[model samples]
Target: MASCIQIEGLLQSYIDEEASVSERLLIEEHLKSCGACSERLALNRATAATLFEVWREDQLREDLTRRVMAHLPEMPPPTSVSAALRRQVVVEGQRTRRWLGAAARLMPVFTPVILIILAGLLWVAWPSYYNMGGDEVIGMVTYCDANPDATHYSQGQARRLHVRNPIMPDDHFETGEEERLMLSLAGPSHITLLGQAAVQVRAPRAIVVTRGDVFFDVFRDNRRFQVHTPDGTITALGTSFQVSASKAGTVVTVVKGEVLVDNETSFVRLHENAQTAFTATERPTVRQGIDTSPYLRTARAVRPDPDAERRFLTQFIRNATHTPAPTEQVFVVNTERRHVNALLLKWMPDPYTSGHAGYTVYVSDSAMAPVFKTTISPEIFQDKQNNMVRLEMPNDMRRHDTHVLHITVMSDQSSGPVETTFTEVAAIGEAS
Candidate 1:
């Protein structure tokens, strides 16, 4: 090989500590004869020795630290038991240090994973917390008149108002005036709205406000299934009732079934005839009321008749199912002639049993009654067909002029009566 190539190979072999004894002797002889080769060999050896010395110094320092700590003045004497303990401590500490170093090295890789876990927890725990700037109120409206159908109203007018549905945030009513406003809603039962009251409504609970003046009835559809008033939170399951607040505190009346009232301190069960009132404050005084007789009485007196509802449903179903009049004038009623045509009537399917189908017919002026009578059924009808009585007006009917022709229909099961009225009078020269 060329001189330069030979020198390069020798230098690499020396660096790798791979030269055989004969090879090392040959390299030494070549170096002694060549000044350049000698200088290169010395330089390489010096570099390698400096590197090895640094590594040795680090090992010595670590050993010295361990030995010195083992011999510290504060250390207990090295009895056989103590020596064993010291060795164990040193081994465990070294293992712990290795684990700590591994953890530190992995910190950059794990940082995003830790942050993602934290973010997921926050999202699941409180969804609303993220929407800190969104408006919470579902709707707001002003009512100025007792009239329920007023489409428009002037501001500040003494009007009866309503808020149909609301999200009912804990911080909704901020003002005392807003709290005093009374609202009522009709669920399967009635509900009384409470003004700014601090109450806790628990789950699986229902509430009733027997009576105390407070305004606002949050309809049952509102998100507030439970109510928190000054007295306490009333929790319920599928209940319709009212809650009232006053100097006496808050009273819950159940319009329907039972509800459980649990203040942070105690719990109580309230039934239809029972009510529970809680006073405000941390150490609240709670009172129970019986004889919900007044509440029951009020509910029955004001509640809409369910029978009327049945009738309403039955009437519509009958009109749609039965055949309709073929012509625009298929059924006609002439008050002047005291005649009615195409009148329909229904009786019980079983003649022996008194079942009422209903009466739908074009009535003449004579058929209209000043006093709406409930008892007149088949006897008042003048026409009869196939064991079925046909409803009609009395031919002699007169005193009741400007007659009204009406079609009345009723349901089989106590559905209240529903009627459509039409005036019988015709314009001058108009056909009757």
Candidate 2:
């Protein structure tokens, strides 16, 4: 025999007097020792009894309604209209009783199911109910390079934000002049910091940009992705846009999707390829279909490293060399790279040049064409016999970004083949 302790379903059958003799005896004996089971049985019995009483009362009411109709017919067969109306009333009452009987039978089965569904709904809506603006990590630094360049302030000290670093609410991301930071948000939203920018993630789904050019590509979401600026706020449901902030004001350019730009006075909805500008105290001036190509091109462009660019320029100049080239060459720039661009020294050794001939060193930033030309006489050589040349570049090196040096031998002696060798080995800087 199955144990009564494990037979919760059997209680219903036992209360209905439908259990076998042996099962009833087992339950009776089990209830004597188990207070919880006895209480549950009593509650079930009381509920059953209550439902039975309600059903009996309804049946009695239904029977009395039928008896009253039968007695009224015996008293008088009324007019045709009255008799037909009475018949309709009796039919409707019978239908109502049938419906109520079915409903009462099904209520017990669906009551628990309805409660479970309601509980699930509440659980799903819990966040919205409490307005959980907690510092939960919604996303991480998906692509962050230039270590110690892009940083976030934490506990009075600035910490570097590297790849895979989790981003929390109120987390501030500030980049140096040369650094750019990329972040991914919860809605699969992407933010690309192109230049020197300072941004802090506000609670939930918003970011405040204080400076620099920031590109945002937010995927579709129920919650809006907000970009808070000094001038106004740009909110989007699903869009790719650019926000360029400066001292003058902020300019919002819509690249693909639509966005709403709100300021102190009013709000304007901007569509694709539309642009708008706003000042700190004023509302945004809307422009429609006004080509956003400039911002679009910039958003798609990658920032080249200054050091790598300098090296490429050096190699281009060094490629135009004949046999027995100058074995020694040096190029050096100041260490203060981000804030300043200065070429401190550039020394190239030419061993075969004539001592009496004047030399010309052509310089350019792109190495495509010479923008500057410096003529050096043989008497100016630091080492005369060795044909060593230390020609001072055009004084505009500090003003411009001088990368490549093209030294063409301006031999006043005998211009045999126009000797040219811009030998660039390694440029070492002085104490910076």
Candidate 3:
């Protein structure tokens, strides 16, 4: 590695906006990892601000910066000069020569220029996803059910992400706590990203999961698909896996195929239904027979919630706690593995027949009106096998839309009348 002194001239050129693109890149990358260099840049900025204060009111920063920096008094071009010296002279001759000499002296070479250039070459040759900097479109957001929590930062703009947003090598992608995003890599494979995560596309096939969890569904054809994290690098092919990363460490779980993890000090290979984790300074510890279903079961297709989420969470909590619950939902929208001819609703209260009378069923594909309505008798509901009621979905409904079903459980109580509405949603072709 080149020392700080070796690249000092390159750094000065960067500040002056006189460096080549490659040189500026080298210094910028260096500044990211070197605190001393970063501090030097800060101090340089402070000095420049002070210098600007002394300039005339009419002098622009650019004008002052471009002003001749040579301290020597100007001298006239001479008719007689050695051929070697004359090489530095242009048509303007000695005046240009003196300026050239002064500029060279002002920007003295602290170290050999060749050495700084060699460092630049090494940086270019270094193996990293960021080395390939470009605006070339690498992928696109295939599915983004984004709320305000989701953002896609590209070039210099940050905005809400949407389907069809082109991804560049340097683009930054982040999601809010409950957001979900998907990226199609212009190939057969794609990436399903969970929320509260930050990601940067290093290459078309490589990504850096800076924080939070991410799922990769990669194809074997995209041979070198890899993910980088604070702790290590994970490489896989023809695999489905999840990576949870933080500054503390990383955890990798393999769903179907194998993955290789390197934590700087060592490497570990994890196969199907296996997992491994490690810190920055420790070797990965592998665990076998791990259940990967939880990671793979993330819901990618989401339908809009119609305020029934309160009931959903209530039911979810009751189920999680092993509380005694009814055999059937008050109302439900079920998923059938294939297209169905009939819409089924199973309603079973804790007691087989708790209602004082019958309940009204209302089904609709829109709020404007119910497509079907009927009074379901509690006696018939209980006597029937499974208390299952079937409704014919509207044939005119959109192929991709879902039907909403809600029922008001009516009972004549001491208060004269009592009613509780149980709501459910059903998708046309979803699996049970």
Best by TM-score: 3
lDDT of 3 by residue, 298-348 (tens): 622322122222222232222334322222224444332233345555532
- How displaced is residue 363 in candidate 1, in Å? 37
The digit string of per-residue lDDT tens for model 2 on 1-432 reads: 346557677899999999999878888878887778889999999999999988986574445776777767455755666777888989999999999999989999999999999999988866331333334655556455545643776434576656655566788888767667766565546687877788888753699999999988775557788999988899998677899888989999987778999888878899988989997668678888877656655554433233322222232222325222322222333223221222222222221122223445444444446545555554443232232344443444534443443334333422222122332322223344
Cα displacement (Å) at residue 134, model 2: 12
Per-residue lDDT for 74-156 in model 1, tens only? 76755765777888989999999999999999999999899999999988876341344323332222111122333212232
The model with the greater lDDT, 1 or 3, is 3
Q: What stretches of model 1 exceed 4 Å from their correct place?
A: 1-189, 192-224, 280-289, 299-432
TM-scores for the candidates: 0.26, 0.38, 0.39
Prediction 3 global C-alpha lDDT: 0.62
Task: Name the 10 consecutive residues with the lowest summed lDDT in model 3.
Answer: 412-421
CA lDDT scores, all candidates in order? 0.42, 0.62, 0.62
Off by over 4 Å in 2: 1-135, 147-150, 155-157, 302-432
Residue 59 accuracy (lDDT) in model 1: 68
